[model samples]
Target: MKTKAVRLYGKNDLRLEEFELPPIKDDEILAQIISDSICMSSYKAAIQGEDHKRVPKDVSQNPVIIGHEFCGIILEVGDKWKHKFKPGMKFSIQPALNLKENPYAAPGYSFKYIGGSATHIIIPNEVMEQGCLLEYNGDAFFYGSLSEPMSCIIGAFKANYHTESGKYEHKMGIKEGGNMAILAGVGPMGLGAIDYALHADRKPKRLVVTDIDEARIKRAESLYRAEEARKNGVELIYVNTGTVSDPVKYLLDLTGGEGYDDVFVFAPVKAVVEQADKILAKDGCLNFFAGPTNPNFSAELNFYNVHYNSTHIVGTSGGNTEDMIDALRLMSEGRINPASMITHIGGLDCVVETTLHLPEIPGGKKLIYTNISMELTAISDFRKKGETSPLFAALADIVEKNNGLWCLEAERYLLENADKI
Candidate 1:
């Protein structure tokens, strides 16, 4: 089989090439990628190349695929896994393959033929053996692609533990009905965290999200209305910290000066991390959810609170398979709408440029259809692009009907109307 993919050759070296795929082995499965959402991690991998932990050391010769948040359909199933999987089944993969030999080896960063950027991929034996490939029954492939990122948010929530006054064992998860704050949290993953906190089983009584950008805060509020979150038993509040005189004091005042029980730092900035530390209540759990590129990233913390208030910190890189399952289940059940996370759409032809300069993009997630050939375009620009192209006109109309957010109808139209790769 032949596949077209965006491959990472070295630092800042990405090539869009068509190559022949080796025949599937007895333990391997063939898949056709439908949708893949570009991630910051992919950008880091593209820039760092061999320096990234997940990328193989000999990546210059043996290039790997460049996407991970993907979902697709099974084209062929090998004999070794015919009973468990069959042709035409939809699937999502948990890229965090914790192999003992290469602990950081993941699908998008480490593999040559199994990354999400390709039109088709060969799921290796180890993926199935490690139980990373999950069967997805969701209607939209984008939701399956989003499941991996949502799982990371879910993992952070689950990893956060609160303590009792006199108990030795730590209680898992954020405190139910407690005050929670997501600092610099108007970004894509931060939006996911807000959705989970509002709709998930464990509900926080008050949820405050902070961002320096007023535009992003407004966008997030428009997608997730405060009224809607209140109905779900959460008092959702979006604050532009840039406008506030003392952001920490203002945030603490929202919780009646008691401070927050769960504080999440979404930005890797040092000041953001310190802000999260300053607003912790007694037994508060600070979950640092951002991944920094710098190896020496550091921030000063209050040791007094650490020794007296029982405030502690925890960080998680990605979610486990079960967390991915939770994400899939939640989306399939129509409980969470991660569509709020995606801000742009494109095709396979745009992967190389987009991956190389993802940080420069202004919007949220950049979703790519691996089989199409369109350039990277923002959802906000659809109406403008519609003047010349009828395809975008129809897409803009559909997105407008869905309150200016990308929907399944938009995906159906784009894939059917756009030129195939």
Candidate 2:
């Protein structure tokens, strides 16, 4: 089968090209990709190219497909796994396949045959054996693509902290029923963290999300309303730190000088990292959530607190299989909403440029429907644009039916009418 895909050749080189895929082997599965979400890590992979740890060593010789956060439909299932994995089943993958004890050979970054930013892809034997393939029965197909990022947020909360108290180790998660903060860059991932933090089983008493951009802070507040948080018995505060004279002092004052129990640094800026460290309370867990492209990026730390206050730092790149399962389950149960993380939608043809300039684009996740040919549209603009464009008018109807949010009906209508739009 022939399909179009975004392939990485070398550093700063990405090409959207047509290629013929080989027949699926007996142990493999063939899938038609529907929705794939662009990630910042994909931007790093495109720039770093061969230097990226996840990129295959021979990527220059054999160009690999470039995407991982995606969901698709099983087009052809191999005989060996026909019973367990049948054709026409909707599926999402936990692309961080830690197969064969290897951490670097993930689908989007390393695979030459499999990627989300393509019309179709093959599921290797390793992915199935590792049980990374998830059959999704969700309402919205975009949720399948979104589940991967949401899993990362789930893993962050699931991460355990250990403290040494005279030879006894005490382990715990984000201090249950305590104050929490997500610092800087309340973009896509930061907003995901806020949603999870507010709705998880162990909800925070006070959740504070800080961002320098006033518009972004307001957007986040609008989606995850303070009224909703109050209904959940959690105080939610959105702070535009740039407007404040002393941001750290303002954050500290919110907690009545108690400081945050868990501080998640969503920006890789050195100043933001340092600020997160300074606001840590006793036994505070500072999660460096953002990944910096620069290898030598460093920030000053208060080692005195590390020694005396039981404050520590932790960082995680992606979630595990269990975390992905937890994310899917939570979404299925309506405990958390991942759809709010998406801000833009485009087709596979636009993925190359979108991946290149992702950081410059504002709003949340940019969803790409691999089979469609459509321009990127922000969900917020559907209503206004619907006035003139009949296509957007149809979309506006779907979004309104779902309470002004993107849902399965909206995704189905968009995909069915993508070519017309």
Candidate 3:
């Protein structure tokens, strides 16, 4: 079968090409991709190409598709797995597949035949055997794509530690009923962390999210409403640190002299990292959430505090299978809303350009529906653009019906009328 995909050839070389897909093997399953959300990690993979650890060394020779956060419908299940797997089953992948203790070789970065940025993909035997393929029966398929990034937040919270008596051990999540802060960037990933922190089972008493961009921070506040958070017993504060003369002092004041119990550095900037470190209370866990692309990226830390005050630092690349499952379960149960992190939506045809200039784009998550072909449209613009464009008009009506938010109804409307647009 022929499929259209965004394939990586070498460093900074991504091509939108049509290629023939081999027949599904006995242990493989063919899936028709529904939605694929672009990630910052994919941006790094595009620039680093073969240099990326998960990307195949011979990527120049065997080009691989470059997307990991995606979900699809099972088109064909191999005969050997007929009972276990079936056609029409919906699934989201935990792409950080550490199969057989192999640290490398994930679907988006390494697998030549399997990726999310394509019309169709084949789930490999190893991925299935490791149970990385999660069956999703959500209202909207985009939830599957958003689950991967949401899982990263879940993993960060799960990996955060607190000292128990004499020794430090994993608390398996953020400090319950403690103050928390998300530093620097309130981009897509930061927004996810905020939603999780506010709505999770162990919700924080006070959550302060900081960003440099006033517009971005305001947009995040509108989406993840501070009023709603406060009503839910979380004292949510969104601050534009760029406006403040002293961001560290402002954040410290929000906690009433006591520093944040858990501080998350959402930006790769060294200054933000340093500031996040300084605002940590005793036994505070500083999570370096954003992965820095530069190998020489270093920030000065108060090691004295680390030694004496039980302040610790940790970083994680991606989430585990359990984290992915937890994210999905929460989204399904309406405990968390991953859709708020999405601002723009496009089709698979825009994957190449979107992947190449993702950093330049200002919006949150740019979701691509593989079956459709359309330009990226902001959900916020639907109402205004609805005046001229009938397509946007329909979308505006749908979003309006769903409290001016992109929900399952809006997704279904867009998919049903994708050709009309």
Candidate 4:
């Protein structure tokens, strides 16, 4: 089979090219990629290339595709797995395949033909054996693509642990009815964290989301209304910390002078990390959720509180398959909408440039439809582009109807009318 994909040769080396895919083995399955949401991890991988752990060391001779959070449909099922999976079924993958053989080996960064940027891919036996090939029943493929990142947030929440003084056993998850704060929490992943915290079974009495950007804070507040969170019995507040004289003191004041029990640091910045530490209540679990590309990223923490007050820290890279299942279930039930993370849409032809320069671009998720030929366009600009293109005109109408957010209707319209790659 022939497939078109963005392959990584080395650091800052990405090329969109057509190549021949080998026949799938009996232990493999063939799939057609529909949508993929570009992640910051991809940007890190593209810049570091082989230096990235998940990326293969010999990528120059054996180039690998670049993408991980993807959703697609099964095109051909091999005989060995025909009973469990069949052709025509829609699916999403749990890209964090921490197999015993090689924990670092994963799709996208580690594979030659099985990344999300490709038009078609061969799903190997390792993915199915690990139970990472999930059958998705959602009407929108972007939601399926978003499930991966959402799972990461869920995993972070689950990974956070609280402790009882002098006890060895650590209690898992954020403290219920406790004060919680998400520092620098108005970006893409931070928005997902806010959504999961409010809607999940575990609830915090007060949820404070802080960001340096007032515009992003307002935008997040618009998408997730404080009034709506209050209806669900959680006090949600968005604060622009840049305007505050002392962010740590100001955030604690919002919780009635009590420090937060669970604090999530969304950015890798040292100041943000230190700020989260200063606002932790007794037995507070501060989760450093951001993945820093620098090898020697460091931040100072208070060991005095760790010894006396039971304050601790935990970090998670990505969620497991079980977390992915939970993410899909929540999305299917309409409990959490990952749509807030998406800000731009593009096609296969745009993957090379988009992936190479993702950090330079401003937005949440950059969604890619693998079979289309179009430049990366923001949803907010759909109306402005509508003057020249009929595709953008129809998409603008659909987005505006949905209150300026990307929806299934917009995706369907774009897929049906846009030029196929």
Model 3 C-alpha RMSD vs. true structure (Å) is 1.7
Q: After superposition, how far is residue 123 of candidate 2 from its true place, in Å?
A: 0.4
The TM-score obtained by model 4 is 0.99
Q: 126-197, model 1: which lDDT tens digit per residue?
A: 899999999999888899999999999999999999998888889999999999999989999999999999
Worst 10-residue lDDT window, candidate 1: 96-105
lDDT of 4 by residue, 13-75 (tens): 999999999999999999999999999999899999999989989999999988999999999
Q: Give residue 256's lDDT in candidate 1 (0 to 100).
A: 93
What TM-score do all the candidates reach, one by one? 0.99, 0.95, 0.96, 0.99
Task: Report, for all candidates in order, the number of backbone clashes.
Answer: 0, 0, 0, 0
List model 2 lDDT by residue over 1-421, tens digit each. 9878899998888998889999999999999888899999999999888999999778889999999999989999888788799888999998888766676898999888899999989899889988998999877788888899999988887773646567667676787788999998478899889889889888789999999988888778878999999999899999888889988899999999999888988999999999898888888889998999999999999999998998899998889888888888888888888777888888877888899888888788999988888777888788788898888898888877765677888888888777821
Best by lDDT: 1
> 179, model 1: CA deviation in Å?
0.3
Error of 4 at 374 (Å): 1.1
Stretches of model 2 off by over 4 angstroms after superposition: 160-164, 383-388, 400-404
Decreasing lDDT order of the candidates: 1, 4, 3, 2
Query: What would the per-residue lDDT of candidate 3 be over residues 45-130, giving only the tens digit for each residue?
Result: 99999899888889999999989999989999988778788899999999987766677889889988889989888888888888
> How accurate locally, in lDDT, is each candidate?
0.94, 0.87, 0.87, 0.93
Q: Tell me which residue pairs clash in candidate 4.
A: none
Off by over 4 Å in 1: none
